[model samples]
Target: MPATSHPTRAAVAWRWVALVLALSQLAAPAVTSALAGDFLASGATNRALITPAGYAFGLWGVITVLSAVTAVVIVRYGLGSWWETGILIDICIVFVGFSLWLVIAAQSWLWVSVVVFGVMVGALAHVMRKLIRHRDDLTCPSWAATLATVTFGLYLGWSSIAWFANVAAAFLDEGWSAEGWWWQFVVLVLASVSAIGVTLMLRGTLGYVAGVLWALVAIAVGAAQRGSPVLVSTAAVAAVVVAVVAAVTWQRLGRRARISPATA
Candidate 1:
C-alpha cells in the first residue's frame, strides 16, 4: 500500500463528514458531563476496580483526532476503490451509533447506553474481523490502511473494555454490590480470559491489546487502592500475558514480512 497523490472529491466529502464526526465526539464529554455529572463521577462508588483513572479517559482525544484523519484518507485509496460498499455503509452506521451513545449516556440512561455501545462495538468488530482476515486483499493507499487500522482498532479495543465497565455499572444499579468480593473475583477472571481471547483472535493488533491493557491495569490500580491484593495480582498477570503475546505476534509478523513473496 504505497501513498497516493490523488485525493478525490469523494475523499473531500468524507473529510467533511469526518470533521463533523470529530467535532461531535469532542463535544460529547462536555455535554455528558454537564447533563450527567461527568462519566466518572456518575460511576461513583459502584465503579471501583473497574474504572480507569481520570487521566485514562484522555485517550478519547487521540481517538477523536484519528477519526478525523480517517475521513481524509478513507477514499484516498482512489475514491472508495478499496472499500466494499457494504463496509462503507457499516462504517457510517458505526459512527452514527457513536453519536447516539453520547446522547444516551448524557441522559444517564446506563442500560440503554450499554445497548447502543454494544451495537456500535459489534459493528466495528465486524469490520475489523473482516479487515484482519483480508488485509492483503485490501488495495487502499498507505495512508488509508494506516488510518483504518488505528481508527477501527482503537474504537473496537477501547469500547470492548468500556463495555465491561458499562455492564458493571448496570449491574450495580440493579442492586449488585462491589462488596461481593467473590463475584468481583470471578468477573475479573472472566474479563482477563476475554482479553486474552481477543488478543488471540486479533493476532495481537496493538490497538486492541493497548485498550485491554489500559483497562486491566487501571482496574488493578483501583483494586490495589482498595487493598485487594487478589484482584490486583490477577489484573497484573492478565495484562502481562497480553503484552507477552503481543510481542511474540509482532516478532512473527516481522519475520513473515521479511520473507520474499517468491520464497514463501
Candidate 2:
C-alpha cells in the first residue's frame, strides 16, 4: 500500500477530525429516556424484554471517552502509516457511520439505526481484526499501535452485545412474542451463553474480555433490578467466568512476551 493512497499532508489534523466526530455524542443521546414517553426508541429502557436497565447505558460514556483517547494517540503514533490505505479509509468510514447511526437513532428510526449500527460494527471489526497483523505497516511507536488495538477491541466487544440486545429489541418491537414466560427466560439464558461463548473464542485480547465482562455484569445488574433471577444468575456467572479467563490470559501472555531471548 503506497503512502499516497492514504497519507495526508496533515495526519494530525485528519485525526482531530476523527476525534471531534467521536465527541459528537455530547449531543442528546440517541437512546431516548423512558421518562420522555419514548419507550419504543432504540435506547429506551423498555425497548425489549432483554433490554438492560437504564444504568447499563452509562457504559457508552466510558467507551466514547476512551475512544477519544484512542483517536488521538493513533494519529500521534501515525495513523496514516499504521494502517493500510483501505483500512485507514474504512476507519474513517466507521467514524462517519457511527455519527450517522447516532443521528438516525435520535430520530427514533429504530430499524434504520440498527442497520447503521451494523455497518459501523462491521467496519470497526475489520480494523480490529487486521490491526495486529499489520503492525509492520505502522510507522508509529509499537506501544501506540498496541494501545489503539486494545482500545478498539474493548469498544468492539461491548458493541457486540449491544448489537445483540438491539436486535432483540427490534424484533420484540416488531411483535416477536416470547410466547410464554418460560421461553422468555430461556431466551435470556441463551443470550448469556452466547456472550460467553463469543468471548472465549475471541483471539487473545484483554480489551475484548474487558468489554464483554462489563456488559455481562451490567446485564446481570439490569436483570436483578427487573427481578429476573434466572437471567441475573446466568449473566453474573458468565461474567465472573469471563473475568477470570481474561485475567489468566493477560498474565500468561504478559509473561511469555517478557521472556528474555536467552531464556527462550
Candidate 3:
C-alpha cells in the first residue's frame, strides 16, 4: 500500500505513451520531409521545407533528450510525490499531443498546423507555471526539471515566432507580399517580443545563453536572406550585449541563492 511501492496504472500508461511519442519524433524528420517534398512537387504549396525555422527544428531532439532524462528522474523518485506525478502527466500530455499534431500538419492540413502549434504553446506554458510554483520541491540532482523547463520554454517561444514567420511567408508566396520595410519591421517586433519573454523565463546565466542563441539564429537567418550586412552585424552585436547582461544577472542570482538559508 506504500505510495512508492509500484508503478500505478496511470504511470504505466503514460510511460507507454511517452515511449511511442519519442520514437515517432525520432522518425519525424524523414517522414515529414518526404511528405513536404511531395506536397510541393504536386503544387499543393510553394514551400520546400517542413518547418519555418529550418535548422531550428533540431531543438526538438534536445527537447526529447531532456524529456527522457525527466522520465528517468521521475521513475527514480518512485512517483510517490504529487509533484513528480503532476510533472509526468504534464510532460506526457504535452509531448504526445504536440508530436502527433506536427506530423499530421507537416504531411497535410497545413493551415490547421497553426492551431496545433498553439495548443503546444499552451501546454508548455502550463508546465512552466507548475515548475515555477513548485520549484522548491524539485531537488533532483540531474536538474532534469529545471533543464526541461527552460528548454521547453525556449523551444515553445522560438517555435511561436517561427510559426508566425511561416504564416507570413506563406501569405507572401500567395501574392500578399509586404511593401517597404514592413516585413523587416514585423520580424523585428516578433524577435523582440520573443527575446523579452525568454529573458523573463530563463533569467541570469541560462537566460543569457538562451538569448544569445536566439539572437544568433535571427541574425543568421537575416544574413542568409541577403539582408543588409550592417543590419545583421548590428543584431549580432546586440545579442552579445544581452548575453553579457544575462550572465551577470545569473551570477548575481546564484550568489544570492547560495547565501540564502533555504538553499544552504
Q: All candidates' lDDT scores? A: 0.70, 0.65, 0.54
> Backbone clashes in each candidate structure, one number apiece?
0, 0, 2
- Give the distance in Å from residue 224's predicted Cα in candidate 2 to where it truly belongs: 1.1
Clashing pairs in 1: none
Candidate 1 local lDDT, residue 102 = 68
Candidate No. with top lDDT: 1
Which stretches in model 1 have alpha-carbon errors above 4 Å? 1-19, 44-46, 75-83, 258-264
Question: Candidate 2: which stretches are off by over 4 Å?
Answer: 1-17, 28-47, 80-82, 177-202, 251-264
lDDT of 3 by residue, 106-175 (tens): 5656556656666665666566665654655555443655665566556555555555544544554555
Error of 3 at 256 (Å): 2.1
lDDT of 1 by residue, 1-264 (tens): 333344455545554664566557767667767776755565533465565555666777787777766755654442233444545556666777777776776666789978988887777777777667667656665556656876888878777877777777777767787665666777677777877887777878877887778878877887777778888888899899989988898899888878867596
Best by TM-score: 1
Model 2: ten consecutive residues of lowest lDDT: 33-42
Candidate 2 on 188-253: residue-level lDDT in tens? 566557656655555557777777777778777777666677777777787787777766766776
Better of 2 and 3 by lDDT: 2
